[model samples]
Target: MPSDVDSTADEQSNGYWFRRGLAGIISAPAFILMASFVGFGGLAREAGWSAGEAAFITGFIWALPSQVVFIGSVAAGASFGAIIIAVALSAVRLLPMTVALMPILRDPKRPGWVYYPASHFIAITAWVVSMMRLPDVPRGGRLAFFLGFGMSLTVCNVAVTLLSHQLAGTVSPVIAAALVFLTPMYFLVALWSAARMRADYLALITGLVLGPVFHHVDPEFDILWAGILGGTLAFGLHKIMERWS
Candidate 1:
């Protein structure tokens, strides 16, 4: 009986490490890079941006929605103010990520230099998953783990962007479209996985319903407004639902 318990505990520990290793393999930086090739870089080429410049932006920005808006709006000859607003709206979610993560990821004794930039790679997917999983990890290891994971993502994005730029001509448009679509598809899947609260569920459903409707009216503002409006409405409705339930 004692041996059986010991064996089971060892297996569980090994399994935990293995899973964490796998999770580190799929970093937000990597996903952001993958999205860039099919989505933004291709569009950038189409819009006359030099491949090097687009790839540079991809490596630096690592924010897909904002990059998309910046590229798309610029392509359409939008004004500086319009482009700024579009990018700003898309990037608003970054604030929430930083707020939620700082308390957990920041080490009390560590200097700001190391932690400040680790905070930069804390995107929606990374932040959400880390929030869910990092608490279970030993406090000292969380930052190290996320650093490795986030850096892997950043490096992969640059590599993949160059590869995508070179290979874009070889692939069919359909495949390219699917590759671009994967980022959002993954996001929805992540959102679904993280939906423990009623407000999150309602927000997702409402946002999906509103996305198309708002798009038809104004393509530029659709995603931004839909998320804001739908999320707000979802929050309100969730409160009512809870009170009445």
Candidate 2:
């Protein structure tokens, strides 16, 4: 029922947002992500993976932790089944991120199936940036913007991984290792900056304080328990404060 002019305007709006999203690669988070992947590429090469293999993993898994787990497991001679389990467990953390972002990116008029592919790109970098930026975008074009941003990051990082794999020895091992920490450091800062609720602050701080303790207690399951306990404590405190107020 819309006129041609109206349809054209809508297209233009979508294109504009998409371009803006693609431009996100020039931002700090994007740079940090790519730098971290340079570390990953070096690690992959050290682990004896081919450039093609490293690029494939980056393009498909698209999750640094999982990719690292895969490379480490292979290098350690882990069984195929064990490697699969390790990678899947490492990636479990992304589920909450994807769940939180779905409502913001979902468009009522679009079919739900479209989001499945979109969800594949929901790494910490994409999720954090989208959560911070998508609220300002028009609801109709949020998906377009996210797709542009997410897809561009994936493509760019994969290329970086491949090139880094080829040029692995050029970077010192210690420096490459330090670079790998940048993504998580950036994630923490970005999460803190984007948090709007007291509960959010509580969860982050509690997680930060407890993470080391849990790591000492059980290095294998530290992240899982720290997240669970931190989140539970934060929620309880928030509820109690609400009641008292």
Candidate 3:
């Protein structure tokens, strides 16, 4: 936790983001991002991506789900427009993430356009840390901290992707696949942290139950159906739970 200081004393400086950005690399949870990206790198190459392409995806796209959608669609021979639409659809989850954290990271002096580019970096690992840590960080330092944090993840992931890409041939498929599990595990834990209400708890439980069943029945649209039906069930269950109590 960080100490509270007079906000006026903490007013903006160009250097504020620089200092916090460095500190973000050493953040305790950051290794989770590194591990997740390392797995992502491995999976990308395993799925037939080149080192250059993997690095580009990590650097620019930055979202694991979007990257997965892009690669999966491309491999399935989806059309150009389809690939873009699929990737964008998979990335819909990010809007809430960006909207949720903007207040902490937005700076009045920087103008709104800067935030759009800044929002590009709002993947799950970094977003979780920002939600948790930004409140304690000085108001002026949040954007820099976020950008720096993102930079650290980007730099490390690029290197990790290259390294993992090399290892893709030598490494067993099982081992490489195991590494890729880190990202989802991070999301599950973070979801647990965020699921404080009855509705949220029900929704998570519903997803856990329905997600696999949906996949078994219809693999193509499994996740989409799981979200829709699971959410509806949870919403109904939450109402029941509310009335029962």
lDDT of 1 by residue, 41-75 (tens): 55565567777887787778777666767887787
Residue 183, model 2: Cα distance from true site in angstroms: 7.9
Candidate 1: worst-modelled 10 consecutive residues by lDDT: 1-10
Off by over 4 Å in 2: 1-12, 171-245
TM-score of each: 0.72, 0.71, 0.79
Ranking by TM-score: 3, 1, 2
Q: State in Å the error of residue 82, model 3.
A: 6.7
> Among all windows of ten consecutive residues in candidate 3, which has the lowest summed lDDT?
1-10
Per-residue C-alpha lDDT of model 2 across residues 213-233, encoded as one tens digit per residue: 987996555555776788889
Query: Model 3 — TM-score against the truth?
Result: 0.79
Q: Which whole-number lDDT from 0 to 100 does residue 9 have in model 1? A: 39
| Displacement of the residue 41 alpha carbon in candidate 1, Å | 4.2
Off by over 4 Å in 3: 1-12, 72-90, 181-187
Clash tally for model 2: 0
**Tens-digit lDDT string for candidate 3 (102-123):** 8777766567898877787788
